[model samples]
Target: MSEVYDRLRGEIVDGTFETGAQLVELALAERYGTSRTPVREALRRLEQDGLVERGDRGMRVRTRSPEEILEIYEVRISLEATAASAAAQRHSEFDLIRIRRAQAAMDSTSTDDPAAMAAANRAVHEAIWVASHNGTIVDLLTRLNNHLTRYPATTLKVQGRWAEALDEHRALIDAIEQRDAARAHDLARDHMTKARDLRLQIYREDPTA
Candidate 1:
């Protein structure tokens, strides 16, 4: 059942099962080569994770509205800024190495490869969360990050967004490395605000966004 749950969740995150697509139990069971029982259990778990919801037709992937996406980012800005502040005070040399490595990966990734850019972006943010040394914040950010994967487009894929993001990340790392908690917090907050604005711009240009 856990295997079924993880595989289905991965597919949803990777955009294999798009938003609002129905996940019929028998279909998923056949796809996973598992019995209907495990498929049923997996769907239940995904529902708990806010990735799936019951609909008139059946269980479908959750489709977030533009308003909801904005609201999520607002919350993300708060949480992530706090995490950056904490990380500034708590991070060790190993944590800095992980963060720098992720940043370097993002820097090297071609702008044409949105998927790799998105993965690298995630790595950079996740490294900061781990550096915070706060289990509760890390767990909350992890859940928020999972919900973010449901979006059809990556913010990093927007024109010129990757370059801006790389610059913001570099500044953020510098603030953290200097143990400037206040500056780290402000930098993180501003970074998220810029990302939110860019994402909204992308959504305005594309109805599907």
Candidate 2:
């Protein structure tokens, strides 16, 4: 049941089962080569996780509204900025190595592979949160990130945004490495602000998005 839950959650997060798409238990069971029992259990867990919800037709992926997106980003910016400041003050060599490795992976990935880039981007952010050593902040940020997965389009896929984001990340990493808490905090906030602006623009341009 846990295996089924993990696989289903991964698919939803990776955009295999898009927002508002029906999640048919029998179909999922067939896809996973299991009985409907496990699939049913998985769907219940996913609902508890807020990834899916019951609808008139059946269970469907949860979609975030524009207002919800804005609220999430506002909270994320505050928490991430605090995390960056704390990480700059307390990070270890191992923490820096993890962050740099994630950045390196992002740099090596082609923009054409948005999923890989997004995953690498997540790695870098999660590394910073871990470096902060604050369980509360990490838990909140993790939930926000999960909510973000409901969006079908990644900001990295926006034209020319990938390069700009890379440069911003480089500057952020530099600030953190230098133990400049103020600089790290500001840079992290600015990065998220830019991302929010870009995402809003994309949403405005594509109503269906």
Candidate 3:
């Protein structure tokens, strides 16, 4: 049952399950070669995570509006900036090495595939969050980022933006490496601000965003 829940949660976050779609318990059970019990339990957990919703009809995936996307980004900017600041103040040499590894992965994959870029982007931020040494911050970031995965990769898929995004990340890493908490905070904030604006633009272009 826990395994079922984990699998379903991963599919939902990675866009395999998608948003605004019905999650029929029996169907899911058959699809996963499991019984209805685990499927129902998984749906319950997904609902708690805000990844799914329940109504008189049944369970369905949650949908986000353009406004909701913007709000999520705004919240991310604030939280991630604080995390970056904390990471800068607390990070050790080992943390720096881990972050550099993630950054290198991002640099390599950002230009290749949307899925890889998304994974690498997540890794980089998670590394930073680990450096913060605040479990609360890490948990919040995990939840927020899980929600963020619902959005399309179109913003990051922009033609010239990948390189620019890598550069911004490099700048952020430089600040963190220097142990400049204020600079790391500001850079992370600005990075997310631009990402928010870009995503907003993407949503505007696609009303279904």
Candidate 4:
């Protein structure tokens, strides 16, 4: 059940299923080479996770409104700041290396490749969340992040956002490494705020978004 759920959830989050794509239990079962029972169970779990929604069109991958996206980011700002602050005070040397290595990977990836950039960017942020060593904060951020993926376009695709975001990530890592909790907190808040702004801008420009 867990394996089926995880696989289905991954597909939705990664855009394999796509936003607003109808999810039929029979089709999913056949695609996953499983019985309809497990597929049905996975769909139920996805609905609970807010990844699947029931509408006039029936069950489909959820699509978020701009307002919903902004609201999620507002909560994200507070939570991300908390995580960065805690990370600055508590992260081990290994944690610091993890964060840096993630950034290094992002740097090595071509900015022209938005998909690679976004994945690398997530790696950097996720590393910091893990470095925070706060279970509750990490869990909350992870869930919030899944919601953000509902809109599949990456904010890094915005003109000039990729380089700017990379620099911000570097500064954030430096603050964390220096054990500057206040600076780390402020940097995290600013990073997410800019990201939210860019996301809305991109969304507004896309009629289908």
Candidate 5:
């Protein structure tokens, strides 16, 4: 059941099972070479995980409204700010190293590949969350981030966002390294605010976004 659930979740994330697509138990069972029982269990778990929702017919990949997406981003902005503040106050040298490395990875990613750049950006954020050393904040952020993956499109694709975001990230690192919690909080909050606006713009420009 766990294996089925993991695979299904990955499929959802990678767009193999698109948003609003039906999750037919028998079809999925045949596709995975498993009985309907495991597929059924996986669907239930996915529903609980907010990756699937019950519809008029059956479970389908969940889709958020624009309002809901904005709400999630608002919550994320607050949480990310808190995480950055905490990280500045408490992060170890090794934590700083990890965050820097993640940023370096982003810098090395090809400019033509927005998807790869976006993934590397996610890695940088993940490292910052871990550096916060607050388990509750980290867990909340991870779950919120999962909700965000439904959008699929990267804000880095917005004109000049890739370069601008990298500059913001560098500022964040400097704040954290300087142990300026207040500055770090402000930088993170501003960073997320820009990202939220850019993403909504992306969604407007492209229906798939």
Candidate 6:
């Protein structure tokens, strides 16, 4: 049931299924080759995650407005900045290796596939969060980040931000490697700040967004 929910949730976040679309249980159950019971369970979980909402008509994919997106980004900046700071102060060598691997993957396919880039992007962030060794912060970041895929990739598509993002990743890794908590926190906050500005700009310009 959790797997089914995650699959549907991914589709919704990644825009494979657009916002406000009907999610009929029978159809989703058939498509996923599962019983309606799991699909129903997935839907319930989706509501808890804020990925879907119950309506008078039925279940509908939630739509994130520009303001809401900005608000989410703001919360992300605060939480993730602290995570990076904690990680820098506490990261193990093994954690640094995992972060490097994720960054390398991002650098490799960055131009080839946007979806893969996004996934790699997530991997890097999660690696840093895990390094912090604070389960509560990790849980908060997990929930806050789950909604980000709603933004069109156009923001990440911005010329050089993807590459710039890689540079930021490098800087973050460097801070963690050196165990410099202040630098890591500042770099992480700066990274999120830049992303927030660029994404908000893109959203304002995208009529379909």
Top model number, TM-score: 5
Clashes of 4: 0
TM-score-better candidate, 2 vs 3: 3
* Model 5 whole-model lDDT (C-alpha atoms): 0.90
lDDT of each: 0.89, 0.88, 0.85, 0.88, 0.90, 0.85
Candidate 1 residue lDDT tens string, 33-101: 989999999998888777999999999999867797788898999999999999999999999999999
RMSD of each: 1.8, 2.6, 2.0, 2.2, 1.6, 2.2
lDDT of 4 by residue, 71-130 (tens): 899999999999999999999999998998999999999877777888999999999999
- What ranking of all candidate models by TM-score puts the best one first? 5, 1, 3, 4, 6, 2
Tens digits of per-residue lDDT, candidate 3, 1-209, equal 99999988888876687677789999999989999999999998778676888766899888878878877878889989999999999999999999999999887783657777877888998999999999998988788776766775656787787788889889999999999999999999998898888888877787554
Candidate 6's error at 36, in angstroms? 3.5
The lDDT, on a scale of 0 to 1, for candidate 1 is 0.89
| Model 3: worst 10 consecutive residues (lDDT sum) | 146-155
Per-residue accuracy of model 2 over 91-127 as CA lDDT, tens digit each = 9999999999999988998777777888888989999
Candidate 5: stretches off by over 4 Å: none
The estimated TM-scores of all candidates read 0.91, 0.84, 0.90, 0.88, 0.93, 0.88
The lowest-lDDT stretch of 10 consecutive residues in candidate 2 is: 200-209
Clash pairs for candidate 6: none
Off by over 4 Å in 2: 14-18, 22-37, 55-58, 207-209
| Residue-pair clashes per candidate | 0, 0, 0, 0, 0, 0
Off by over 4 Å in 6: 14-16, 26-35, 152-154, 207-209
Model 6 lDDT per residue over 1-209, tens place: 88789899879876788888889999999989999999999998888777888777899887768888788988999988999999998888899889899888888874667777777888999999999999999998888776665665645678888889989999988998898999999999999999889878877788355
Task: Give Cα distance to truth, residue 135, candidate 2, Å.
Answer: 2.1
Model 4 residue 69 CA deviation (Å) reads: 0.4
